[model samples]
Target: MQGALRFGARLVAILVLLAVLYSAAALSFALSPVSGRPQQADGEPLVYVCTSLAHADIVMPSRDPLIDWSTHFPAVTPPGLPAGAYLAFGWGDLRFFREVPTWADVRPSIALSALAGVNDTALRVIAINPPANDPDCRALRVDRAGRQALIDYIRATLADETQSRPVEQAHLEAYYLARGRYSPLRTCNQWVADALAAAGLPHALFAPFSFSITWPLEKPPLLPGKS
Candidate 1:
């Protein structure tokens, strides 16, 4: 029984060490600023960065009907989204797309595989019509150059280099294969933070969790007519 006890202790120590290293790396990459603050130019677009407890996504400015997201993405965007709906984008492990059809399908092994970056990646898109004053969302205004750079970075995340456009798959509605190496170190939270930094918006140097990314947006409410 002493042998069993020693093995268990060793396992715990290894796990603890991994946790510390992951935390350190996540903070190091996530927090570093991309560049100086962006200057707002004429006709700069305004976008929103939103997050949930486990994931982070971008709510694109989709109020304009002329710009059909389908043309750009060509994927299964669920029908019946409101005319003024915003397109939300999220990136995650490829195994997560194939295996975890629902949260119930998640297992410890699968989660670990994903966190270790052994799996591929996918991008999920959805349409949303959030309330005008969403406390959970933060607006980021980006100049033309910054906005273009962010868009290019987003498009480059597609997994298929040959496919100039997105390859729509039937089984997973509103999701497409994405390019990028995702691990515990490069998590969804970090992706959102990186995207914001690319857009030249004010952002944290590092964000490992949804709260870490959204904390800057969630300030105490202001009184009516108060600055």
Candidate 2:
């Protein structure tokens, strides 16, 4: 019994150590000089970087009628968004996004697979009018080229065939399309960071969490009613 107890204690210690190390590495990357660039303040053609409690998304205007979002992701606007909708793009674990509508739907296997890097990647898209600036979301401006590059990156993430597309979700009124694979190291948050970097924006070298991805957008994060 004592031997078993010792073994359990050792396991706990190892887990705690791993968690600490992970946190330290993430923070180091977050505070690095590379991620310190402030969001571009140039007006118009602004793009929003939104985040929820556990996820991050890029919100951009639907300026080009040629690339109509409704035609591609019709689920976003069933009755047709006449005024057009601001497109929000997010990436996550394929199975988790399909099965887990909210955090409440999380399962042990889902969590473990995402953390173990054994999961496939999927994209989540939503089209809303005027875009949302809720407590969880913050807007950032991007140049025309930057926005186009970001869109290109998203398109590249999607497989070249329709067979890769997953079934649309009825809950969030969003579509889940198969894209890159996911792992502990290549999490959705990391993808967001990479997207920002690919677009010539400043972002953490390894943003593993939503907050880390959102933090660099504003220095000394603005508290409620303070800004």
Best by lDDT: 2
- Using TM-score, give the best candidate's number: 2
Q: What TM-score does prediction 2 earn? A: 0.82
Error of 1 at 195 (Å): 1.1
Summarize candidate 1's per-residue lDDT along 1-227 as a digit string, tens digits: 99999999999999999989867755554455333353554464466777666788877755432245655654434455555666777888867766777778989999989878887788776666753478667776566666676666666767763453443455224666787778766778778777777766545567777765665444332233455
Across residues 134-186, which tens digit of lDDT does each residue of candidate 2 receive?
A: 67777666655666678778777776534434466653356565566786577
Q: For each candidate, what TM-score against the reference?
A: 0.74, 0.82
Model 1's alpha-carbon lDDT is 0.66
**lDDT: worst 10-residue window of model 2:** 33-42
The segments of candidate 2 whose C-alpha lies over 4 angstroms from its true place after superposition are: 33-43, 64-67, 77-79, 161-166, 220-227
Q: In model 1, how large is the Cα lDDT of residue 76?
A: 39
